[model samples]
Target: MLVSVKELHQQTNLGDVHKEKPKKFDHLILGPAAGEGLPDRLQCQGIKALNKIHFGMSRNNSRSIDPVAFVTVFTIYNSTVESRPVDLVTVGNISYNKVKRSLAILNVFINFIQVNMPQSKVIILTDPASELPLQKDMVTIKPIQGEYSRDKLMLQRIRSYIAFLETRLEKLSQKQEQFTHFIFTDSDIAVIDDLGQIFIDYPNFDLALTFRNNKEQPLNSGFIAVRGTAEGIQRGKAFLQEVLKVYSSKFMKASRMLGDQLALAWVVRSNPNFNVRRFSRREAFLDKIGGASVLFLPCSSYNWTPPEGAGQFHGMPLDVKVVHFKGSRKRLMLESWNFFSSSSDLSDTLCLILKSGRTKYDF
Candidate 1:
C-alpha cells in the first residue's frame, strides 16, 4: 500500500518525530494537497522523516515531485595570485580579498539553499586545502584539489561535474535510489527562490540553460539543470561532452576567460542537430538536439543580475529566482542577502517595485 507524505506526517506527528529516531516507512509518495503543490516547509519536514526511513518511489502518475529527488552541486576553489588571470586582479599588490569574497558569497548561497530548499541534497566540490565546516545530512563536500589556472579552472569544473553525474547515473542504473534532478550552479550566486519549480513546470527536458539579453554572450553557464533519468542523463552528458570539446579546442582561444559561456553558445548555434529558436511570444527557447530537448529560459527570471551602478539594495523582478553575482557584482550579494533575510514579505515588496518595462529598482 502507498502512503502520501501528508498522511504519514499526520499519523507520525512529524513535528516531534524528528526529536528521536524515526521508524522506517516504506512505499511513500508526495501527493499534491488541494490541487496545489505541497508547502515548502511541509515538504522539507517530510523529507527529513523520509530520509531517516526507507521509502520507494510511488508508481502513481502524479505531477507532484518527491521533495528529496533533487541534488544541487557547486564548485569552488581558492585561487592564489600565481594562478589567477592577470586581467582579473587588481593593479596593486594582490591580496586574498577575491578568495575571501568568493567564500562569503558561497556561504550565503549555501545558507539560502538550506533555508529555501532544505529537502534537496547539496554537493560541494572544492579544493582539499580549503576547510569548510559543513556536516549536515543534506550537504556533502568532496575535495577536488589540483593545479589551478585560468584555463584549467573551467576545465576542472566541467570534468568534475561530468564525472560526478556519470557516477550518480551509474548508481541509478544499478537500481540504487538516487536523486532524479541534478542542479549545477556556480558558487558566486544567491538563490532567492526555489529552483525545483523548473523541473516541475518543464518536465522531460534533458538540459535547461539560462540565457541573457546580450547577443554577444547569450547563454549563461552559471546555472544549469540536468534531468537524471537514463535518457536525460545520456543526452545531458552528450551535450556536456560537446561543450568540453569546444572549450578544450583552440577555437575559444580569443576569449579564454569566457571560454565556458562562449563554448556553450558555440555548441548551441554551431551544432546542426540543435534547433535554437525563440518560442512564440514567450521568453523561452526550446531546442531539440540529438533527440534531447533543451530549454533556454530567460535569465531575467531564472538567473537575474542587478544592473550596473545600482545602489547597495535594489528591488528585483517579482519572478526573479536565482541572482547571479557575476564579476565585481559579487560584493553586492551580501547586501542582497541582507535584504532577503530581513524582508518579512519578499513577494509583496517585489510586486510593488515591478513597474511596466522595469525589472529592477533604479535606486
Candidate 2:
C-alpha cells in the first residue's frame, strides 16, 4: 500500500509526534509534492492560488509562470532527522520545459528526502519573481539581484545563472549561524537514496563534490554539498562561478560538447576550500545496470543526450541511483526512455517528452 503523508511522518520522525502541523515553513518551491501520485484538485487549486499571490505581489516588470508548471508543497517526511542531516537547497533557472521536468524531479527528490533525511530543510533559490511558495518545511528565497542574458550564446544563460547561485551563496555565508551546511543540487537530478550516511560516515571531507570518471576532470555538476564555515562557503561559491565562466565560455565559443561537468571541475580546481572526492558513477545513473545502484554519477549519463548504448558498461550491475534527464536532447531521451522497464516511471515521463518534443513543458 502506498503511504499517506501522515503515515510518512509517523514512520520517519524520531521526535515527538505532537508537534503542530508545520504551517510555517522553512522553504518552498514550485515543484511536486512527496508522493507517487500526481497532484489532486485541491493541490491544483493551491498551486493556482500560490501563483496568483506570487504574481500579484510582483513588481510591474515581474515574470510569470503557469500555475501547473510549479507545484507548491511542504516538508517531505521520508528523510529521518538522525539519518540524513543537513540543510537542503536547489538552484535552477525557470523555463516552461525545465519547470515541468523539474517538478517531476522534485517529486522523486521529496520522496527521497522523506524516506531518508527527515531533519533537513529544503530551500529553493532562483531568479527573482520566479513564482515559488513557502511550504511546511521548505521555503523559497529569491536572490538579491542578478541578470539573465538572452544572447545567442550556448550554455551562457545556464552558466550565468549558476554563477548567480554562487554569488548569492557567498552572501549567505556571512550569516552562517542560520544554517549548518548548505547543499546545491540541480533540478534535473534526483536523489535515489539517503545521503546522510555518506556525510556522517566520512571524515576529513569539507565538501562533497560530484565529478565524471576520475580522470581529474569535472563532468557532472548535479550535486554539491558545501560546508557552512565562512571560508568553506566562499570557496564553494568561487569554485562554481569561475568554473561556470570558463566552461560556459568554452561551450559558447566552440559549440563543443563540454557541458556542466568540465565547468564544475574548473570550479573545484580553482576553489581552495574544496576537497573533491569521487563516488560510484554507476550509482548515479538512473537506469538499473547491475544489482548495485549507480551513485557517483558520470557527466555523460547526467546530461541531455541521445540514448546510445555507448555509455553503459554491459558487464556492470543494474542499479540506478540518480538520473539527470536534461531537456535539451529530446530525441535521445526518447530512445533511452524506452530501454528501461515499465517499472521505471521515468519511461512514462520519457514518453511524455517524446510525444511532445521541443514543445515546452508538459509533465
Candidate 3:
C-alpha cells in the first residue's frame, strides 16, 4: 500500500532529479480544490489498504479515513541579518537568511509535503510582512497579528502555536469537524512519508512529542501531534499555557535563549503530575502529564537529523520519515533531498516503518 521513493518518482515522473536550481512551486496544486473533498478512490481505498497491508485493522473495526482528518501546520516569519544576532546569519540556514534563500527552502519543504501527502490540509502561520507564494487552494496561509522581532523568536512561535490550537478548539466547539488530528512542525522539516499512520497506530494519545537520545534535552519540540477531541484540545491548551508561564517566569531568565524548549522540558520533568515511562524495547516513552496522555516517539524515526560529514546518509535508517534540517544541517538536508530524489534504488521505507511487527502500540 505504501509506495517506495523510487516508485513515487516513477509514478509522478519526477524527471531530471539533478537540477541545480530548485523547481518553481507557484502553480503546483497536487490535490483537489479548496472545498472539493478527496478523490473517490482515496476516500474509499486509502485507510482500508493501510489497514490490510500495514496496521492489521480488520474491515469491521477500521474507521473511514478522511483526507481532511489530518492537518499539518507550519510557522515562518521574516527576519533579516541586521535584526538578528551575529551568530544567526548563514547561507544554509533559513532563520536569518535573506528573503530569497529563505523562501527557496520553504518552497522545497512545502513541495516535499505536497508530493508525499497531497491529500492532507496544510496551514501556514506567518507574519503579515512575510511573503509566501503558496496558492490559497493548495494551502491555507494565515497571518498572525504582531510585530516580528529577533529577540522574541521563540515567543513568536509559541504565540502562533497557541493561536493554531485555539482556532482548532473553537471549530471543535462549534461542531465544524474540519479535522481530527493536527501536526505542528517547524518549517525546516522535510516530510518524507505519510504521517496519517501515526494517528491510526497511536489512536488513544492526546499529545505526541518527539525525543532525542540526549538526557539533558530529551525532548525536541519540532514535531508535535495533537488529537482534536474535546479533552485532548483542552489538555493541550493547558499544557502549552503552563509552558508559556514557565518560559516567562523569572527563574528561566538565565537560559531564556533556549526559550520554549527549556520551559517544555521543565514542565514535563519537574511537574509533580507528570509520570514518564520508557519503553523497555524501543526508544519510545509514554508520559502522563496532568491526566493527559503524552506519547514520546523517538527522534530517530520522526525527527531524524543527518550526522556530520559528507555521505553520512549511509547511516540513516530506511524507515526515517520526517527529517529536520536544524541549524547548519539545512545544507545537508538539501543535499540529501537531491540525493534521495535522484537515487533509484531506494525502497518503500514507509511500509517497512509501519508494519505491525516493526512497531508495537501496547501503551
Error of 3 at 353 (Å): 18
| Tens-digit per-residue lDDT, 1-363, candidate 3 | 123334444644566666545332211112211111223211112112221112123222324543423233333444433443533433323333445445556666776776666666677787777766667446778787654465665666667777778887998889886656778887777787677667677777888888654545667777888877778777777777777788878334533256777777888887575544442123556668876788888776678654421112223344456767665444433433443455521232222222211111111
Estimate the overall C-alpha local distance difference test score of candidate 3: 0.56
Residues 33-82 of candidate 1 have per-residue lDDT tens digits of: 11012222111222122111111122132236644333333434454444
Q: Which window of 10 residues has the lowest lDDT sum in candidate 1?
A: 354-363
Model 2 residue runs over 4 Å out of place are: 1-108, 133-136, 149-179, 214-218, 248-251, 254-259, 265-311, 315-320, 328-363
TM-score of each: 0.66, 0.45, 0.66
lDDT preference between candidates 1 and 3, better one: 1
Winning candidate number (lDDT): 1
What is the lDDT of every predicted structure here?
0.58, 0.37, 0.56
| Count of clashing residue pairs in every prediction | 0, 37, 1
